[model samples]
Target: MGLLMFYEYLSRIEALIEKHDDIGLHNYLDAMHAADIAEVLENLESDEQRQVFGLLTDEKATEVLEELNSDDFSELIKALTYEKKVTLLDLMSQDDIVDKLNELPESRQKEIIAFLDYEDAADVKDLLLYEEDTAGGIMTKDYVSIQKDYSIYYAIETLRAIAPDAETIYYIYVVDDAERLVGVISLRELIIASPNRSVESVMNENVITVNINDDQEEVARIVSKYDLLAVPVVDNGNVMHGIITIDDVLDVIEEEATEDIYKFAGTSDEEVYEHDDTLFDRVKNSVRSRLPWLVITIFGGLLSAKVLASYQTTISANASLAMFMPLLAGMGGNVGTQSSTITVRNIATHMIEGADILRTLIHEISVGMLVGMFCAIIVGTAALFMHAEYHIAIIVGISMCANMVTAATIGTIVPLIFKRIGVDPAVASAPFITTTIDLTGLTIYFTLATMMIANL
Candidate 1:
């Protein structure tokens, strides 16, 4: 639905551009939603983007500019004139303006800051003081809050006055005499209650709130856990600063998912899927994030080599052992990776809690056991035919069972241990699990072969 709407709008935008110069184009673009315009702008070439942007009203241009990804925002800022940039900055929300400013170089950011209105500039400065991945960084200072003493009638009128500027009015926070957050009331309740009822009487005291210092991922987890529309943010004194809305939480979720995916693939979180970034810049980002992981994996491989070399005599005496080595190691790695992936994802999403970690481990172990038993039967039968030795069959079956069980156990435990140590479980689990399984599988294969086959 959104794509179709955007395509229809883009066709209209294109037709308008053909018929009219910048001024007329600007008028048409100003009438569209910021999100729709952003979609269209992103689809256009650089030259086309400049042309379309030239046609937009200052406010509309800023809205669409702020809606773009960081890479696109940086590009758009470079294309615009100093005067136009100042005008766009003036029109954007303080939070959005700060975000854009943060993406620019120091000199560019200083120049833009100089052009901002003193009050707006201060808000941006304060927001920029926090780390980018905190509740303080993403929140807006434009949320609706009312004194607890106001009657529902007065509150309604106040909401009407501020509704245009506020990002969301779903939950109106109630602050006390010292500006400390005391309670909250939903817009639905406010509308349904008696007009004369005081906000203090109607509001619920048990408000869910997050501190400014809380991690953005933690903020997202809280919002998702409580199924909240918006969560208030407060300082140590309980003074209301801003509220993190569902929209912001959604953005956090996307960012966290992107970060985890990049980490898994040995890439950086900053690598975005936009054309605005240069090839060299992309490669720089990729290499910086990936090289360390590759180096670590190299060491892991060396460890595996040392383990295999330690059993050189076993492999020399029975060259057939070398044939099944790759098979056993490969299967174990696959199973370990599968378990770790599921466990890490479940833990990150909060679907699996700390208390349930043991249960999840047991469940995964059961799955691994079933899988191992099935594979052991198949491989054991195959070994009986190929080697015509009952001892080789027993050795293969026992090795398979042991390796699978070990893989499953390592896969389940590694992520949990990473979580316990305050490391991102997803980032550390996969490689570690695969390495452990490789070492354990090779040891089991050789040890079982030595004991069982030598007796036969």
Candidate 2:
């Protein structure tokens, strides 16, 4: 259903709750999908969330909880007793449980870990050894594996026993006696193949896998490129560790994208907005997030101001020249922003390489020249209509063209240089690029005005 429909349904449920209709609320929640339930939980008050959650069965509740984001999950779980938390933890996938536990303090993490069964605790401990942004950190241990020597019938039976608890059984992995990944067979192949055929004979040996220490973005790229349901994580010796499912990759994609967006806007990762945070909290966070960037931008503005001040003599002689300053600077900023944004996106997606950087910059500068010519004509016409001196018209037009060309060149090169030096291109944001252009554009405008108008 669309967001509107979901909100409408939530309103009806909220009215029922207000009327003390437990049966109605329970029935409503029971009928909703886990994702929908999670959405409702996100918007509800603390007590309301707990009340709604209580109506769900253990299995359904587990699914709903898993659908919630980290903040929502922590808040909802805080209302549960230790025993209830333990029950819920047991029902979750190992990777998800690890993620949830990692968000808590060390004492709380230990408390949560103690509730798991010995084997589960051990698995979680092993997973916690990896950094949160690595393949091993997010890869679930709940994948079905069978011996390569097993017959199709035996593999099928093995799947039946494990499918109840396994996160994904679509691709059954075949490992050697040493527990090293040897091949993989899809569930369709296992079901349709001759019952007595050996797993080794049917499995595809050329399996694509990621190292346990691989970055999550790299893992996401590999999965996207291969169109995989899950990719196995392996050690140096090809010992299968765990499998990163498509769902985990989706989470990583969202996280990385959000982080990049925040960085582009000149903020830290913690500044990403949350729907549930209080108004005060949001305002406080926004101020904190924006202040650092604002400070840097202000410094850039001061430098531009200094350049303008240095051209005071020329401005005093021809006050009309100052009138065109904003136009030239604004056009330069717009052009630079457009060029840099595209370059940054391409670099992020691995579409731009070091070899392509020069070609990309040249193309952008060429585009700038064409765009600049049109802008200069428009601005020059407007200046002439304002009854400005012919020299003023000529200087303003030339300044606009030159500023735009310089803006495009600088914008293209700055991002590529950042990428080459291992800096995120997204960090070179519009504000930063615009500030740079402003200073340069102003200097060019004043210098040209001084020379052209002096002769007139």
- Candidate 2 accuracy as lDDT: 0.88
Q: Which residue pairs show collisions in model 2?
A: none
The 10 consecutive residues of candidate 2 with the worst lDDT sum are 268-277
| Candidate 1 C-alpha lDDT tens digits along 41-105 | 88787777788877776767777887886657767877888887777877777767667767777
lDDT of 2 by residue, 370-453 (tens): 999988999998999999988888888888999999999888989898987888788898778888999899988988887776
Q: For model 1, where is the 10-residue window of minimal lDDT?
A: 265-274
lDDT of 2 at 196: 90
- The true-versus-predicted C-alpha distance at residue 286 of model 1, in Å, is 2.7
After aligning candidate 2 to the native by TM-score, how far in Å is the CA of 215 from where it should be? 1.6
Against the true structure, whose TM-score is highest? 2
lDDT of 1 at 223: 96
